[model samples]
Target: MKVSVQGVRGSIPTSGSQTTQFGGNTSCVTLMEDGRMIILDGGSGLQKVTLPDPEVKRVDILLTHFHLDHIQGLGFFSPLFDPDKEIHIWGPSSITHNLHSRLNRFLSPPLFPVLMRDLPCEIVLHDVSNSSFEIGPFTITSQFVIHPGATVGFRIKGKSAVFAYVPDHEPALGPKGLIFDKKWISGFELMEEADLLLHDGQFTTEQYGKKIGWGHSSMEDAIQLAEYVGVKRLLLTHHDPAHSDTKLNEILDALKSKHTGQLDFDLAREGMEIELG
Candidate 1:
């Protein structure tokens, strides 16, 4: 399986010189192999996606939640306007609203110039919960996680590799902080023993102290979870919009200096690609 990072920033788009190296676009990632494409999230980085070959007739996008930073680029994704393409979107289901209704709140007039119903492509929306499904050659599991609203984390299994994504998790919200027992941890099943895990590392420990329930995790917390889950490699994503390239590097460097474990981990950067087997 091949994974590509299109956006790493969290909360809002922060395109500027200060964030050039790590990128300022919000959460989006792509997995491509054997002519199949699977997109995770639809943030401002959705605009950065290059369409797959014409032979690939369908593409599926799995969204974590309805947050603006996660779905803001749906209207700008060029392929959505292509009449010949077929697009499938899967998102966390709500008791009061279906997937289409929730998405319409953003793709309708006033919020967006075009309405969801007006898109030229054949768009299909699927409501997901604690379920498993398949798209092309990949098997996916989507489950609710500890985040604001109806957010979910995804576990994707290819022929030879596994990848887990949880870009807005706050599993350490309680006083105990990230229970060591896997059975009690949020999103633990999605990440356990995966080849690569991309997770939220949006705040520093100091910042997290002030925003306990903001649906984001500190870098330390992210690493701790990844280590506990025994993932082979960890990519810390969802960078705070306020963290500049220099500041990000400084924080990572400090963390690395104190880290003595053999775990392979690093901050996720836009355009970075990893081929897992």
Candidate 2:
């Protein structure tokens, strides 16, 4: 399996010298396994994704949540303008609305020039209520997470590896704050020795103190989860827009100082491509 970090920013986009190293575009990732292309989220970075082969016509996009930063790129996705393309979108449906209705509300009318119904390509929206499903060569299992709106974390299993993605997640905040003893995450099974875990480490310990319950996790929370699961590699993502490249480096430095040689982790950066076995 091959994974690429297309964007790493959280909430809003950023720019200037402070963001050049990591990137400014919001949540989006491209995953490839056995000649199949799968997109995780449709943030502004989705616009940067290109078809390596023009002959490949079908694409699958798995959305973790429908926040503006997550879905902002759908309107500008180039394939949507191609009549011959086939796009399938999957996400959790809110208690009040279905997936199609929620997406159409933003992708239509005064907000955007082209209505979703008028798109040239055939777009399918699947509302995920059950826990597991299959898409081509991958088997996906999702579960609701701790977020304000309906949100889910996904565990994607290819032929040889498993990848877990949690773009906007809050660590266990319930009264029982035990790490390993409690199943705080929705898709907990995905954490078991995952080849790569792309998780939300959007805030630092100090920032997290003030922003508790904001539907985001701190670096400490990410580290704890990775340590508990014993994942081969942990890649922290969903960077806060306010955190400059230097600040991010400081965070990395702090982690290095604490764990010594015990753990392997890294910060996910834009345009970073990696292969997983």
Q: What TM-score goes with each of the models?
A: 0.99, 0.96
Candidate 1 overall lDDT versus native: 0.94
Name every residue pair that clashes in candidate 1: none
- lDDT, model 2: 0.86
Scored by CA lDDT, what does every candidate get?
0.94, 0.86
Residues 65-131 of candidate 2 have per-residue lDDT tens digits of 8898999998988998999999999989777988998898879888788889999999988888547
Model 1 is weakest, by summed lDDT over 10 consecutive residues, at 50-59
Candidate maximizing TM-score: 1
lDDT, candidate 2, at 29: 95
- TM-score, predicted candidate 1 vs. hidden true structure: 0.99
Tens-place lDDT per residue, model 1, 59-87, is 79999999999999889988899898899
lDDT, residue 244, model 1: 99
